[model samples]
Target chain A: MSDRLAMEDRRSSRLPFPAELGALVAMALAGLLGYLVFPDDLAFLTRLIGIVFLVLSLDLVTGYCGIATLGQSAIFGVAAYAVGNACLAGLVDPVALLGVGMVAGAVMGLASGVLVAKFQGLPQLVLSIAVGQLVAAMANKLSSVTGGSDGLAGISPGPVLGIFNFDLYGRTGYVFSLVVLVIVFVILLRFVRSPFGLLCRAIKDDSLRARMIGARVYPRLILMYGISGAVAGIGGALTAINTGVVGLDSVSFERSAETLVMLVIGGAGTLWGALIGSVVFQIFEHYVSAANPFHWMTILGLMLIVVVLFAPRGLVPLAVSVVDRIAPRLGGKS
Target chain B: MAWTVLGVVLDAISYGMVLFIISIGLSIMMGLMRVVNLAHGAFAMIGGYLASYALKSLGVSYPLAIILAVIGAILISIPFEFLLYRRIYRKSDELTQILLTIGITFVIIGVANYALGPTSKSIPLPAALSGPFDLGFRMIPAHRLFVIACGLCTALLLWLLIDRTEFGVRMRAAVDNGDMAEALGIRTQLIFTAAFALAIGLAAFGGVVGAELLPIEPFYALRYMVTFLVVVSVGGAGSIAGALSASMLLGLADTTGKYLAPEYGEFFFYLAVILAVFLFPNGLLGRKH
Candidate 1:
C-alpha cells in the first residue's frame, strides 16, 4: 500500500530533489539574472527585500503554519513606521534600523496573537480587521511621531556599512536586498526542515489532532505569529530604511490583501512561491502602471479573479505540476 | 437645553436606525455564509450610484429614483450571486471568500469609476424631502425622518421575514446547521441563494436611504467595510437585534465623535472597533458555538 501510494504521489506529485534545493537554485539564478541585466541592480534592492519578507513570512504564516491572516500588512506598516521614525531621529544604520523594525513588529504581533490564537472562523477574520484598524489608527493619530498622511520625506539612507549610496536606479538596493534574501532563505530552509518546522506544519494541517497527540498548540502559534511578524517587520523596515519614505500604505488593508495575494499566487506554504508572487506582482505593477495607471488596478483585479477561479492552488503549484510532467518525458521519472 | 438634548438623541437614534438597515443584511450573510464579504458596502454604494443617476441623469423624482435604484441593485446582485459568490458557498477556507469578494469589489469599483467617475455623486432629495418636518417642539429634516421611519419599518419587516415566516424558519435552521437542514429537505443551496439575494437587497435599500450621508464613490466601499465589520463584530453573527443595537450605538458614537472631534473621528472609530473586538469576538449577542 505504501509503495502504491508513493507511485501515485510521484506520478501526480511535483517534489523533485527537495523544496529547499529548488528554492535555492531559483533565488540564486534570479539574483544572477538581475545582476546580469542591471549593472546597478542594487538600486531596486528594496524590491528583493520586499519579496523575501512578503514571501517568507506569508509562507510561514499562511502556507506552512496554516494561518490565513489577511492583516499581515498591518505589521509591515508598523515596522515601516518604526524604521521611518528611527531614521528621522538620526538612526542611520541599516542593520540597526532593521532591529528596531523587528522589535516593533514583535511587540505588535504579540499583542495580536492574544486575540488571533483564541478564536477560530469568523472571530479570526473579525479580529484581523480590528487589529489592522488599530494599527492604522495609531499611525494616523501619531502623525507627529510618525509622519501622518504626507509620510516622512527626504529619508535618504547613508548606505550599506556606510559605503554604498542609494542610486536612482535601485542597483544598491537590489544587491543589498538580494544578499539579505539569500541569507534569510538559507536560515529559513534549515529552519523549516528542522523538527520545529515539521511540528509547525503538523499543527497547521490539523491543530486539534496535533493537540490531541501532545503538540503544544498555543505556544507554537504564538511563537510562529511573532516570528512571522518579525519577518514582515524586517521587510517593512528594509523598505523604510532603503527608500526612506514611510507612509500609511504600509498599514493599509489593500497592501495586506495584496501581499496575501502574492503569497497565494506564487504558492502557499512554499517560500519560493511567495518570492515568485512578490516579484511577479511587482514587475506586473511596474509595467502595468507604466502603460496606464487606471488600467493597472483593473488589470490586477481581473488577474486576481482569474487566478482565484482557475488556479486556486496558485501559480507555483501549477508550475511544479507542469515541470513534473515535462521532466518524466525527459527521463525525469525513474 | 432640554430640547437640544432631545434633538441630538432623536437625530442619533434615527441615524442609528439607518445604520441598522445597512448592517443587518450584511450580518445575516456573514453569519450564514461565513464569508466576510468586502463587497457588501459596494452593493450599498451601487444603490447610491443608481439612485443618484436616476435622479440626476434620468430626471426621475427622488423617491422614484430610490425605488429604481433598489430594483437596479437587486437585479445586479442576482447575477453577482450566481456567477461570483455561488462557487464559494460552504467553503471552510476563509481566504478564498475574502480574495474572491475583494476581486469582485475591485471590479465593481472599476465599473463604478468608469460609470460614475471617481468623484462622489449625491442624490438630491425629492421635493417632498427637500424641507423639514416640524414636530410640536422641534423640527427635523423631512428626508431624515422619512429614512428613520423606513429603516424601522424595514427592520420590523426583516424580523418577520427571518423569524416568523416559514422561509425564515428554514433559513434560520440552515444557518444554525447546514447538513441537518439539508437532510430535513430544506434545500440549503436555494436558501443560500435566496439569503444572498436578500442580503444584497437590504444593502441596496440602505444605500438609497442613506445616500445623503454615505455618497457613491469608488473607495467608499473600502472605507465603510470596517464600519460594517465593526457592527457585525459587536452584534455577533446571526442576530438582528444585536446588529440593530450595535449599529445604533456606533451611529450615535460616530455622530458625537464627529461633533466632539472632526479630525479624530475616523481614528476614534477604529480605536473603538478594536476595543469592541477585544470585548466581544462572537459579538455582544453571539451565542457560543
Candidate 2:
C-alpha cells in the first residue's frame, strides 16, 4: 500500500512543516469555519463529524488495508447501541460513554474480522455484507434490548469533561465532536505512518508475499480491523450523544452502503481523502437534498458516475492536482 | 402437521425457484464478466414496472406484458452496456465496479420513483393463474405452479443453450478464458454483449413472473440486492448448477425458518449463508482461481 504512496510521503516530508500538522491545522480551521457558517445546523455538522469518523475507519480497512467492506456500519452501529444502552443504564458521562463505545466496536470488529480476514476478493466482500446483515438482524430481533426498529432514544449524554452541558443549539456537542475528531485524526495520521501500518499495507498489496516473507498476515489484518472498529465505534458513540437516539438504521445495509459511497467519493487509501470525502458528500447532500428532495438520488448518481469516469482517484486527489497546477511550490506539499 | 409441512415445502420450492430465476442472471454476469453489477436488480425492477404498466395502462394480455417487459428491459440496457459498462469492463478494481453499479442502481431508483410514484405496483394475475390449484393433499396457488414451471423451463432451456448451442460454447469458452476465446476468433465483445442482453432479459422475465413473491416498487432494486447476491455467491458465481442448489437451499432455510420462528427468519437465512460461504469460500461450485 505505502509502496505506491512512499514517493508522495517523502516529498511531503521535505516540506517546512509536517503534513500531519498541516492537516490538523486545516481540520481545526474547517471545523471552526463550519461552526460559524452553520450555527443553526450544528446538529447536522456534529453528525457529519461522526460520519467522518465512520469514513476514516472505513479507509483503514478498505482503503489502506485493501479490504472491500460494505458492512462497516456493523461496528459503528454496535458501538452506538452499546453507548446508548450504557447511557440508558446510567452511564451518562460523555467521555466514559465514548470509551464504552470503543470497546464494543473493537469486540464486534474483531469477532467479524476473525471470519472476514480468512478470505479475499468477492468472497470477502460477501462475507462482510453477511456479517453486517447478521448484526442488523440481531439488532432488530432483540428489540427488548436494542429497541429494534424503533431505536433507542432519550440518551442525553452528560456534558463534555463534566462541563459545557449539551444544549439545544448543539454548540457544545459540535465543539466536543470536533475536538475528538481532531484527536482521532492526529492519532490515525501517526497510526498509518507507523511500521505496523506499513506492514498492513504490504499485506494488503500482497498477503501471500507478505506471509512468505515471515509476516503474520492474519493477526495484522485482524488487528487493523479491530482498530478500525474502535474508530467507527467512537463515531457511533458521538451520534448517540448528539442525537440522543440510536436507531436500527445505524446498523442497516443502507448505512453501510452510504458509508462506502462517501469513502469512494472522497478517494480511498488516504486519511485526508476520507475526511474530505465525507465532509463534501455530507454538505453536498445537505444542500442538494434540501433543494430537490425528489431528484437527489439521481443527482448523486450522476455525480458519482462523472467522478468514476473522469476523476477515478476521487475528489481530494483531483483537488490536489488542480492546486498543484496553479502553484508549483505547493505541489510537493500535499 | 403433514399438510402444513407439505405447504411449507411447496411454498419454499416456489420461492426458491423465483430466487433461482432472478439470481441466475446476476450469477452468470458476475462469473462471466466479474463485473459485480449491482445494477442487475435495477433491470429487474424496470422489467416489473414495465410489465405492470403494460398490464394496467396498455391493457395488454398477461403473456404479452411479460414479453414486452423483457424486450423493453433489454432495449433499455443496451445503451448502458455500450456507454457505461464498456468503460467499466476495462478496470480491474472491484470497488470501482461496485460503485459504478451502485450509482446506476441509485439513478434507476430515483427515476422510477419520480416517474412512477412511490407506491408499489402489482401485476394482476390472469384469471386462470390467480385461482388456487387442487392437489391430492393440498390446494396451492396456481401462480406458484406457473412460477415453478417457468423456473424449471428456464433451467432446462438454459442447460440446453449452454451445453448444446454454438453461442453457449462461445460463452463457456469466454468464461473459461477470455483471452484464449478472443484469440480463437470468438468475438468475445460480441459474446459479452449478447450474454449481457440475455442476462438482462432473464432478469426482466424473473421480475415480471416473480412479482407476486417480491413486489415491484421503486426501491425493489436495493431492497432485494443482498438476497440475489447471496444466492449467486452461495451457488458459485458462474455455475448454474451451483446457483440452483444454493437458491433451493436458501429458499428452504428462509421459508422453514419463518415457519419455525417468525422473528428469527432473516437470522436463519443469513446464518445459513455465512455457514455456506464459510464452508465453500469459493462458493459451493465456484472455480478455484
Candidate 3:
C-alpha cells in the first residue's frame, strides 16, 4: 500500500506543473477571448462563468467522490439568497458577500451531505432531487424575503476596490467574476491533486475497499459535499453579484439537471471538462436559441443523446484521446 | 365542514387514481427492469395530446380516441424500446439511464410543443361523462367518479394479471433474478419488450383519462415527471399495492396542503418525500435487496 501510494505520488508529481500551467493558460485565454469577441454580452458571459463554477463543484462530488446528486443547486440557491439578503441589509462589499455565500453553501452542504451519505444508488438520486425541489419551493414560498417569482432585484455590488464601476456595459462584472473564477480554480486544482483528493478518488472507485482500508467513508463524503457546496455557493454569489438578481430558478430542478448535463458533456472527473462543457453548452444554447427560438430544445436534446451514446466520457476526454494519439507521433519526430 | 372534508376526500381519491394510473407503469418498469424511465411522463403526455387532437379536431368518439391514443403511444415507444432502451439495459448504470431518459423527455416535450402548440389542450368529454351526479348528501362530478372507477378497475386487473397468471409468474421471476429466470427458459428479453410496451400503453391510457386534472400541454412531460417519480419512489418501485397506497397518501397530502396552505403545498409535499426517503430509503414497500 505504501509502495502504491509512493508510485501514485510520483506519477502525479511528474506532470503536474506543465498540466496545471496549461490549464491556467487556457482559462485565461478563454476569458480574454470572450471579453474581446462578445463585449456586448458580458453579462451573459459572466453568468456562464458562474454556471461553470457550479458545474466544477458538481464534479467534486459526482466525478471525484462518486456521489450521484441532482441537488447541488440547493447550496447554490441558498448562497445566492444569502448574498442577496446580505446586500439588502447594507452589506455592500462584494468580497464579504462572497464569504457569506460560501458559508451558507457549507452549512446547506453539510445538512444535505448527511442525507445524501446515508443512501446509495437510486435513493440518493431521489433524495437529491427532493432536496432541490424542496429548496426551490421554499424560495418561492418565502415571497416577502426572496421576492417570490419576481426575484430579488436591484442588487448593486459596489465596485472592485472602489475603482471599476459596474456600468451598463458589464465590464466590471466580467473582470470581477473572472478573477474569482481563477482563484477558486487554482485552489480546487491544488485540492484535487493533494492527498485528500487522492483519498476521495479511491473512495469513489470502491468505497468498500476504501472502508476496509480504515478510511472513514461517510465523513469524507460529507466533507467533499461541503467543499462542493462552498464552490457552488461561490458560483451563486458571483451570479447574484453580476446579474444583480437572484431568482427561484437558481434552485429549481431544471438548474440541477442542466448543471449535471453540463458536467457530463464536459466529462465528469476532469476539472477542465467542467469548464469546457459549460462553455460549449452555454454557447450552443445561446446560438441555437437565437437562430431557431422554437426548435432549439429539440436540437439540444438530440445533441445530448448523441453525446451520451457516442462520447459517454464527454468531449474533453474525447479530445484528450485524439491529442494523445497525435502528441506521441509529433514528439517522436521532434 | 363535513361536506368540505368529503369534498377533499373525493378530490384526493380522484387525483390519486390519476396519479396511480400514470405512475404504475413507471413503478413496474423500475422494479422489474431496474430502469428509471423518466420519460414515462412523456409517454403519458403524448397519449393526452393524441386523444385531445382526435376528440377536438378529428371529431372522434372519446372511447375510440383514447384507444387510438394508447395504440399510438405504444407504437411510438416500441422503436425507442428496441433502439434506445435495449442498448442501455445492459449498462446497468442509473446515471446513464437518467441522462438517456431525460434526453428522450426533452425530445418528446419539443415534439409535443410543435405538434400540439405550447398552450394547454382540453379534451371535450362526452355529455354522458361531463355532468355532476347527484347523491343524497352531495353532488360529485361524474368525471371524477369515472376516474375513480377506471383506477379501481386498472388496479384490480393489474393485480390479477400480475398475481394469477403464467406471464406474471415469469415476469416476477425475471424481476427477482433475471439470470435465473433466463436459465429457466423464461425468455427475459421478450418479456422486457412486452412489458415496456404495456407500461407505455398504460401511461397513454392514464394520460387520456386524467386530462381534466392534468391538462395536456407542451410542457406536460417535464411538469408531471417529478410527481410521477415521487410516486414510484415512495411506493417502493415494484409493488402494485405500494404504488396504490403511496399515490393515495400523496394525493391526499397534496390536496389537503393546497387547501390548508396554498403557497407551501409543494414545499410540504417534497418535505414529506425527504422524510419518507430518510426513513425508508428503499421506499415504503420496496423489497430489501
True contacts kept of each: 0.55, 0.70, 0.62
lDDT of 3 at A236: 94
**Per-residue lDDT tens digits of candidate 3, residues B90-130?**
34577778888888898888777776678998999999899
Q: How do all models score by TM-score? A: 0.92, 0.97, 0.97
Per residue, candidate 1 scores C-alpha lDDT tens digits across B83-191 of: 8788887774877777777777777887777766789888788678879888866777787788889888887998899889999999989988999999999998899
Model 3 clashing residue pairs (backbone)? none
**For candidate 1, what is the DockQ-based docking class?**
medium
List DockQ, one per candidate, in order: 0.61, 0.78, 0.74
Error of 2 at B78 (Å): 0.5
Error of 2 at A242 (Å): 1.3
RMSD of each: 3.5, 2.2, 2.0
Q: Which candidate leads in DockQ?
A: 2
Q: What is the interface RMSD of each candidate, in Å?
A: 1.9, 1.1, 1.1
Candidates in order have lDDT scores of: 0.78, 0.90, 0.88
The candidate 3 chain A region of ten consecutive residues with least summed lDDT is: A1-10
Q: State candidate 3's DockQ.
A: 0.74
